[model samples]
Target: MTEIWNILFNPLPNAIMTLLTGMSLVYWLFTMLLGDGFEMGTDADIQFEGADVQDVDMDADTQADLETEQHVEPSFFSKAMDFIYVGKAPMMVLVTLFKFISWIVTIASSLVLNLAAFGWKSVLILIPVFILSFFLLHYVAIPFVKLYKNVGYAGEEAHEFIGRLGKMRSTIQGEQLGAIEVVINLDVIRLNVKSKDGSLLSYGDDVIVTNQDPNKKFYIVQKDINLNNI
Candidate 1:
């Protein structure tokens, strides 16, 4: 047992093993802690800024084409392809692949170093590290990939709604107990809004979809011009 302990704890080999193990641990920890909350994926409508909403026609044929497309199940190989092809933010798959490669390299190198430095007895140290790596990869790394994907989808979805034109389905009055219903993406969303001038607006008032507050997750709207009057 003393001889086995010496082989496992030998200062020279343990130094390299510890460094690699610590690096792997830190990488997993950072992804788990921060990657989940951060957004990833492309905003489909990012380029439509400052353009008149009326000028941009929502093509029915294009919408129909998009709707008719079949959802294909991405094979493991295809997912890997996406990681390479689609280089978007919050790199979930790519980071995971890198971590996987790191683990492989770390374990292989550790094994070689251990064998050279301490022979077969070093297998004892390798066993525990291998087990630790497996648990960390499965529990920590996998969940982070899922979390980053979710955040990415949400960010992209929210971006789509920005600058969309909607009608005032209900009156938006700033008076006590006054609220407005706006049709956004054909969905009537109720909003508790105040006029920019702090005046009460009437029912069927034309309101423009303005800004969305991230912290409050609500829309900041403003009055729109009456086309009939214009």
Candidate 2:
């Protein structure tokens, strides 16, 4: 046990990789509990400031940089990132996979080579390890990339939910959010919703979608009106 711990932390390469791997583990734990709340979006968001950008305090250099950024072509580094399928999967997914692979390779090589004596010189080994990790990530991310492309990103069509009729999947009252199960064409759409009128509605109540919040975070709903009463 002492030998393993000593080898892992005493060496610079293993220690750096271990720290990255531990951080990745914490990231995955949070993701599992809160979904991909931290994912950097599947698409690139590179945008140059346009006419709409407020220019009240914008300096000449900042404007020049933005203009230059607009026409700048993709560099080899960006293309290489795409080639490795990094942008297709969740950024952290690729990062975690790469860090884990690097950690394992470093530890295994350390065990066989007694690399602990190398000290800071061992950090040089990370270059090759990084290359190998990305190679592995490319293959691992292929299927997932294909799947996300086909499924499309979530909430792409939330606008369709307005005026839809659905049944409460859980009790809701006042401003409390709850799940409502609706069918859009053939697919079941369950979403978090709040009562439009602060009315008490139970799990089995039928409801109609009224409107959406400005931010589109959740839908506003009210109890479905029965025509028989009128």
Candidate 3:
């Protein structure tokens, strides 16, 4: 038994042992901070009613009633993932935080291992380990995190009116600091608009534009009172 323990734990090749210890410590710290092997999938909760498998000749009314109750519930995980990649969470913050924590653990482990073994030469082995960990964490882990966010757990119907025109729900002004809700392709989209005439437009206004310019990142809207009068 003692021989087995010695063989398993013995630092026969001191350099390899130091590298293994550092790597193990890094894995422990990463899992403890981030999560258990980074979740990379999304799932959605859906509910269905009137699923009568036994009744082959079901009434049309009952079948229609069942269809009415069937609905899909969007998953929170998909939204969170979208926010990470498509939204505004900066990549620098994600990379820097993980790197900082990993480095702290690596450095501390190297010190502890050297102290226990009473060897000055073991310190040299840590340089390669640190470099490898840094590269893996930055290039590999960071990209995986972004990919998980982009792919999402479940699929989402693409917003069809992202590039179409929409009627402004409220007055859009040059300096106004609020969003406008527009109905496009039967979907409501909230967008920011800027005024080209340096004037404030009223609610139920029509905003027409061929393209969005840097000067007016929102919209340069014009009033369509004829449509509103109806």
Candidate 4:
């Protein structure tokens, strides 16, 4: 137990990775508990600013097609991120996975390196360890991404939840926040939600989805009148 504790928090390198790993684990647990709709990263509508413009004159169709291609083309950073299948999985999910794996590798490598080399600081070992871990994560996350891709909203399914009936799993104070469970294509999905009105909705309360804020990835919900009458 003492050794495990030391590996997780005592050493400087282990401490930093431990915090990252713990946060990542917590995010995953929260995502599972609340529903796959809780997002802690950027939304799909990310726009790349200041892209190079083409000055060639073309027909409307050709121009439109070129614009579409440009929009679809991943930026350099996004292309690099593809090594870890960024778009194939939720950002938080990917981050959590990478951090957890990095933490484990950091601990093991630190122990081994300490034996071979004396008087080396944990910080010095961190740079190389992190770079190696990132390379390993790039490959390791592929299969996991493929596995989870079908389970969550990888594409068009992201917007399918709109207009669906949702049941509150947690209380939502008006203008505050809450969580709700809804069924889509026979899959029970949980999503972060906010009341459409400034009213309190308690757990087990049935609500109706009125809209979705893509920027925040939260649903705007309202009390179901029919269910309230029951």
Residues forming the 10-long window of minimal summed lDDT in candidate 3 = 47-56
**TM-score, predicted candidate 4 vs. hidden true structure:** 0.48
| Candidates ranked, most accurate by lDDT first | 2, 4, 1, 3
Q: Number of the top candidate by lDDT?
A: 2
RMSD of 4: 15.3
Best by TM-score: 4
Question: How much does candidate 3 score in TM-score?
Answer: 0.27
User: Per-residue lDDT for 1-230 in model 3, tens only?
Assistant: 98544433333333345345556557657865876443321222221011111111224664354335323232464344333332212233344444554444445565456433745654465466555655455444556444533443111222322344555434445555223344433323344545556576555456553334344334344444455555
Q: TM per model?
A: 0.26, 0.47, 0.27, 0.48
Across 92-202, the per-residue lDDT of candidate 4 in tens digits comes to 666777787778887887787662243336656677877787788888887766555434333214435567787765665756556566654443445667788768887
Q: Single out the weakest 10-residue window by summed lDDT for candidate 2.
A: 47-56
Model 4: residue 4 alpha-carbon error in angstroms: 1.7
Off by over 4 Å in 1: 1-162, 169-179
Q: For model 1, how does the per-residue alpha-carbon lDDT over 1-230 read when each residue is reduced to its tens digit?
A: 98554433454445455455556667668856976434333343432232111112223553344234422233564344233322222334434444554445445555566545665565465556555554454444455445533333222223344454444333443422223343433323334344555454455566665664444324555667776635
Q: Candidate 2's error at 212, in angstroms?
A: 21
Which of 1 and 3 is ahead in lDDT?
1
Residue 38, candidate 3: C-alpha displacement in angstroms:
23
Q: For candidate 2, give the lDDT of residue 177.
A: 64
Candidate 1 lDDT at 230 equals: 58
